[model samples]
Target: MTLASSLLSAISGLRHAFFTREGGVSQGIYESLNAGIGSQDDPVHVAENRRRMAEAMGVAPADFLSLYQIHSPDAVIADRPWDTATRPRADAIVTRTPGLAIGVTAADCGPVLFADPRARVIGAAHAGWKGALTGVLEKTLDAMETLGSKRPDIAVAIGPLIRQRSYEVGAEFVTRFTETNPSYAGFFVPSERDGHAMFDLGGFIRMRLEHAGVETIDDTGIDTYSDERFFSYRRSVHRKEPDFGRHVHALVLEAD
Candidate 1:
């Protein structure tokens, strides 16, 4: 079987993918391509999987970048070549150099890719709920801008997150958003479970991007928690599984 991923027509200087699990060599619960190196999967397997990903992106494994994502608003700017594992702590990374990829491993959270073609800058972010509410996306955009990126010139995309139909959260979640803007409650759909509601995560991201002045945006309509092609922390917990996998969503610039 073939691996799953999406192609972006708008990302001109880069080759990007919201990669899925079908094309790796891992097995059992981790099962074929668990790209989350820090996951419970064997280190060698994760290494091989990431190498395959580099080949797919037309870059060496050293060109790939990821973060020690903690769902915070922090951003890291990479000014030079660095190994993927050694990249610093932050949910987002931006670089003005080409051949450098920005990536984030995710299950249900959003893996967001950004590129500013004119400025030769690229960025990637992992914006889970906490990161989103805390302005992770904005931080990434700001870092990219500092490296000479423009909000209007940046093409933004989000991949393989839990969709609203699959995301049910507690009422406190709604209260938190609504406390910021009374109308923010529109993103929630009341759930069958008491005091819980289905939240529109992708919608919230889009809403914020629009607010942040991003004119071009695309969303990869994959739900990690609901689909077996991807991984989901919540789904694993609900299924009582020992562990889950994280798919890598990456964006890499092609050096001129």
Candidate 2:
């Protein structure tokens, strides 16, 4: 199944989907629609799955783009498609190019889709805690602005990810956040385990976007860890699985 944001849906000339782990040819743990190019899944299977995704977005497979995603705060502007072997090493992608589907891959980390219909610019970011804290969201907005997108006019949608109730963090993790800004502590609450707390990743991502001057925001409120329909890194780890699949959340500006 594919999920979408109504706020983004209401806009014309935009196409996107927060694709779940469904409707593809991948097998085993990647059991369908796994778009992670870096995964251990068979390369042919991955390509076929991505082809289906590209078809769903009404773009050729070559026009569907994603990054290597090193969890950095970097955001790059995409004007043309690049080979998967040469995918840019960045966490976010912004583009004004129509018919080019730009996306980010994620399991438990947040996948944020952004669009400014007025400027016809769109962006996708992989917001793991580190990336979000280090400024990926702000960087994405900056890149969009370069393409004539106004921060206030950009509408953002936060996709499914590990929610607070299912995301437990160690003391060191909490310390890292609080040390960044004492107010960040508000995003965590005590967990049953001592020296650990549940982190609200979705809330933090939304807060970062809001601070970056984006006013129209929506969250899918789907938790990957607890939801079987989605793939999840944490859940895979907890289950002692070797690896997890990734979902591709993409956005495209349709051509006339």
Candidate 3:
């Protein structure tokens, strides 16, 4: 089965797609299409599954660049081959190499893609609440800028992630963030569940991008938890599932 995705023309004129869970060869909780190599799913299956994703993106599977996300503020500058298996412990990756695809695997976390068409620089990052708060998005922008991509000229997209309506968090989640800076209060809404707060992830990301001078932002508002079309770690955990599959969102530059 072929998965569904959303695409946009980024600054670098690269082909960028946000893949969903409509296609592939997995089953049960993994069900039909699980692209997460980090999951318990068969690694061969994951490779073949990624091969399909790369094909859809119009590139070889090896051209797809991604990282084992650690939800940290770190963003790696990937200029060439890096071990995909060891998977650098980073949240974002930036590069100027064409035909190299940048991808992010996310269920509820944000998959962000950036491009500077003039400079031929592109980036992909995984931005969950921790990453966003810790500056992964800004770090990606900075990395791209260092490689000759301008922030103002970059086009960015925030892919399928957990939406505010479907996302609820405990007081500690709120307290720590609030304590870090009450200004982050806008990102969270007061929920009825005790000291819990609902987070507006897309909104928060947009704010960050716009602040960094990226006004052209595409937001895929689909919630992973609320929508069956995508996977959600939080949802899986709530159901007492031992593990959950991850969805991949990729952006790649096609050879001109």
* Model 1 weakest lDDT span, ten residues long: 1-10
Candidate 2, residues 217-237: lDDT per residue as tens digits?
A: 999999999999899999989
Q: Rank by TM-score, descending?
A: 2, 1, 3
Q: How high a TM-score does candidate 2 get?
A: 0.99
Measured with C-alpha atoms, the lDDT of residue 121 in candidate 3 is: 87
Q: Give the C-alpha miss distance for residue 30 in model 2, angstroms.
A: 1.3
**Alpha-carbon TM-score of each model against the true structure:** 0.94, 0.99, 0.93
What local lDDT does model 2 show for residue 174?
96
lDDT of each: 0.83, 0.94, 0.82
Q: How many backbone clashes does candidate 3 have?
A: 5
- Stretches of candidate 1 off by over 4 Å are 1-7
In model 1, state the lDDT of residue 197: 97
Question: Candidate 3, 26: how far from true, in Å?
Answer: 0.9
Sum up the clashes in candidate 1.
1
Tens-place lDDT per residue, model 1, 114-191, is 888888888888888889988999999999989989999988887879998899898788899999889888889889
